[model samples]
Target: MAEWTIGGVLDAIAGVIPDRLMTVCGQRRSTFADTADRSRRLANFLAGRGLGAHRERHTLANWECGQDRVALIMRNDLYPDAVIGCLKARTVPVNVNFHYTPREVNELLEYVKPSAVIYHRSLGAKFADVLPPDALWISVDDGGVLPELPSAVRLADALVEGAVDQRISPSPDDVVMMCTGGTTGRPKGVLWRQCDTYTVSMNGADHAYAAEIAEKVRHAGPPWFAVSPLMHAAGMWTAFAGVLGGQTVVLYDNRETFDPKAVWATVEREKVGLMTMVGDAYAGPLIDELQRNSYDLSSLFAVATGGAATNPRHQQALLEMLPGITLVNGYGSSETGNVGFGRSQRGDTRDTFELRDGALVLAADYSRFLHPGEQEIGWVARAGRIPLGYFDDPDATRSTFPEVDGKRVVISGDRGALAEDGTLRLFGRDSLVVNTGGEKVFVEEVEEVVRAHPGIADALVVGRPSERWGEEVVALIARAEVRAAVTHDVLHTHCAAHLAGFKVPKEFIVVEQVRRLGNGKADYRWAKSAVLREVTPA
Candidate 1:
């Protein structure tokens, strides 16, 4: 049987294709052999300091982690190294949002109780006062913006040049923690076994042996450019999946912000084959860049957007500009890996996905699995190769990942319906659903119609308080230009044409920009607050 461990598979790939390019970020490039060596050294360093699996998965509860945790508070450059090294050493790597406020950072760190922290020098001050005193601090240089912590050790200095440690064994049951962005509420740590995460993240590309995977990767694919931040699951998983499949992974260099021009130039120069982005927050600017200037994107074949709501208008515009390119909209969450994906080409506008194996729609009440042709909306769910549960939250763990018909499945808050043909009609997150006058309206559905208008640049829909109706639908619109002729009546007319009368926005507030996280996911909390501030009497 295969080990099915990340370190084991990575080692096998390195043995087979030692000279293959593994990662490229700006001028820094690393081959598989070089990466493996560095990873082994880091693993050894951690192991020597007594960091490894302390207990097996079966020995601990679903929400409990027996392994030491390391918080990763850095950008894309050395992010993969930290994850690979921690896994190799049997230490769980927890993702920390670099864009988080001081209080948010402190709260997350306190919840995870990480034993060590790997951060960029630019962000040292944020963690200095909040980090656990006993935690090991390993800092990476980021233009030397902030002073280093008192007990910090440079990453380069910690690595020791030596042969791979033969005695260090990694288990398939070892945990890999992915922390949610806390956009809806407080962030919870979703924990998955190494084997399960590898299978799911690779879209169920599992083989019996590491040697089999190595042989299959003999002919490497074209380079994959990961434009999303590594702190997010979408970005980290895509980059890891690319390397595991024997493809060079290109990291986006703009650490502070997303620069579409620089991204396109890098894609042209590196000949990036597939680029991963997070919806309109990325696609809107990229479309603007493409319209303003042309680049040699001959090497680009596929552009995939995930981890957020992708505007159909942006998708169609991209398809029109890049002839013969496939626009893929991936559908999944941190709890359930890659459940389904929708593909679009030139002249195509629909956003329905064929559910993968072990994925289906549960009844609205979650009493049973809904079969194809179910007219009622339900929760989108996945059974096999799912996470163990959210760490340290037994109640949430049981509620999110429950047993149905004697089978364990994870329903990650997505509301959708199954078509007669078995395609999934996703209706955004259930948390974003607005109930107006006893009618449930999916915000994504309304936002789609509003953004389709030529004058609108982007829009977010939320429910605000109302005297008559339980809650009234409200839209926050950002125009394409300051002087663009976008009004509440114009948007209402456009939305009314495509949607039911109740789904139309009752009120519209023009804003400079729609609130979004660094990873392009909607900031619902921000939107709701903005709406409250606007509607509340002064």
Candidate 2:
């Protein structure tokens, strides 16, 4: 029989691998049996508090639906339990970025209109004022003094108040809502069915080997670590992929910020075989740390990254630091999961990815698909194993998830060219493309050149309104050192050597730092503002 729901798959794996390690954090460890029991207890507790699948339309907001939504407003450590419980209870898990401001948090909560909220006690004060009165609040203690909130009940207390054996079988169509548009704009919930998400994003087991997942785990060495924040889909998908493969998940517990030393320490101690990060934003620091100190990273065989751009320079730096280690740059989004994988190796194109069978380069018109060997630029699209749609936004659902040639596809606004050899050379997001003097320049391409500079820490490329050209390309840079020997002429010379003159930045603005989202994606909105602020007269 096909395993329809995520909880069912987890249970099947746990039943076989009962004593296998499931999760490991700073001081917390859980076996498969322990994970199952805790999730069951939490599921029962949530059910008792009137949290279960409700498929009626919500009366509160026009852009709201009646899926039993459980918002998670905590750090990465509590994600596995909350996500598992939500799945087992037949409820949708909505990821809430705890880093958002109170206003942003309020906006997301209002839009999602969740039936329950599982949050860290540290954040209760930040979001307590905006929570829905009808929503059940379960607070997880972070071993810190938490502000008293009248609406919250301790998670430990709730776990003991409910039955440990309560089980509810969910259909394959049950929703698992993941919020996209991180750290910018109002968050939109991407609705994905449990089974589709599992097969497409998570590494689901074949039916023949489903019952033997434990034996596979018993033979495999080392755990998988997700270095990215779990609130984002990439990290959550990494954790799920590890669990589905019957491998233990080693979660980083540093809630403050990205600490490369601590991460290396954890990897060395746990013998993490595979680790996931988010592009060059993470790779740069990890490479710098390797240069500073050495660790027993022999157990680590592969490192994977997604959700942002990873330039070839960063890949080369990593390979230089750790020879023979595989570096994978994954191309994907919340709507289109696992579109393609780019193995960063010697002589590989910097930003190019090998297209998976289901991945396609659709014509800019979206009328037909562009075949391989077509030199025309097209939107990168994917068919088969895509999301259901954006929750509560049927219009957006129709626009993004369109049916082409009698087949459904999801186009997440990424633009790329299909090469003669069938490899896809990603140009970057069409929305962020800068057109200067009738010539199109991809910011990501230019940014890659800028970031490749040894003296530059980070860079953001934006278009500034110009009298001569329609829109001139401007670069905002963050220096690697306090007094680095980097200048406008030096950068221009570097970029000119690699790219066409029009694609080079006309002006460079030096800043203390470049803004990035928690998930390591470029804050284009912030970059645009910074460009305007610098170019405008005082």
Candidate 3:
């Protein structure tokens, strides 16, 4: 493998190919030529705003150097060129979540202390303080309300000037901070180096998935539909892969809400072949949308759902809804690149598992088995692609990323076990254990039963803090609006059909919307907060 940098990859792609389509945003599209040209201009624009010059040369001791960071907060618009600009100007792009409130956004900015922050006007206001007080805040309106940042520069104006290719990388190992929240309370910034995140999107465009895409969009570059958030590697991988692997990227501006009807309609209308999904959220909604109206889906060849533990039932329902489509549970994280994953054949999993060096497994005590060399099952460990551990948090790095048996590995904390056939069978996350009267309740089993309810759109299992029982099992459900079909009594009766007596939630709290962070993950902490706030004692 060659030493890869973001700029290096771009240069290689530019050398091998030109005039290839890179991105498709609604009616607009950017060719490889366009991306390169615009990135250079954006870099120049960024540099002119002192993002490169930085108004000073900081010294480590006596030797002075420029160490500027440029942050980005926007939804998936399929414009890798903007990200590419950070590499050019030796700037690190710290990801800012658009869903974050002003307070949450400021915490990220305080941690990064970026020199310049770039954002699309669509989701940039509350995140204004994510940059340092004295830092430059740049704005780009992709047809939205443009916030007035004091030193703001328009991206369109920069692109109007001629673009020239030039060097713009600090180091291969320099951090490009991308933030994602987890079961933990606050969000942890996953920082990727210029060389760390390999683009597997270009291994060979003749593969089955790529070939299927090529068959649909035979015009120019390989086209991919962006479904996940731009901050997530799930979305970034396809976008970059499409660019390097000869595909055009089509971004679905979902605007933080997953509307299955609109997504399927776009896929059929624009002829999207490859897209990403995150577990049940994508599959279930697609299945739900099917009952509403039938849409043409012959164009879609594959959809990779990841990020969370998916039940076999939800996986089965997805396939039942849309037969003949390739539904794969492709697994990976911010720290791990494309590791070995299994494709569903019979009921979410009937296919045999091939245990590679790094396979995910469920441990005996509801812990993640990361690595097991000799025909053993454990949590999946892909230390090879571990992100620069939770930016600025040494304690977290120690806990999550630890050295076992001499080599450093990332402890995913997901539970799974190994089969004799050398495949990892993931169960659920370690933190998802529900304790009730000293008995441990795994949420995966409970969620499986509760999600089976016909009227339930979504369900989450969380333990409510109890003074008497230690922690009581509670379920927060997002039920479909079917004229009061699912009352607490009805759902409790439904759970009795599948779950053990004690595993059933002690109380049911119904809500119009289920709170979730990006990548279709349930924010259990917030859900618990909401449940605690609303629930009354008997």
- After superposition, candidate 2 runs with Cα above 4 Å error: 1-3, 56-66, 182-184, 205-218, 346-351, 432-538
Question: Which one is best on TM-score?
Answer: 1
Off by over 4 Å in 1: 1-3, 161-166, 181-184, 432-538
Worst 10 residues of 3 by lDDT: 56-65
Candidate with better TM-score, 1 vs 2: 1
Candidate 3: which stretches are off by over 4 Å? 48-67, 129-131, 145-147, 160-170, 182-184, 199-222, 346-348, 351-377, 432-538
> What TM-score would each prediction reach against the true structure?
0.81, 0.79, 0.70
Tens digits of per-residue lDDT for model 1 on 415-462? 899888899998867677664533446687678778899998888889
RMSD of each: 10.3, 10.4, 11.1
lDDT tens digits, residue span 362-463, model 2: 999998999878878899999987877887887788889899999999997888888777888887766776645434466877888899999999998988
Q: Residue-wise lDDT of candidate 3 within 67-110, one digit each (tens)?
A: 57777876666347778877766676766655545655676677
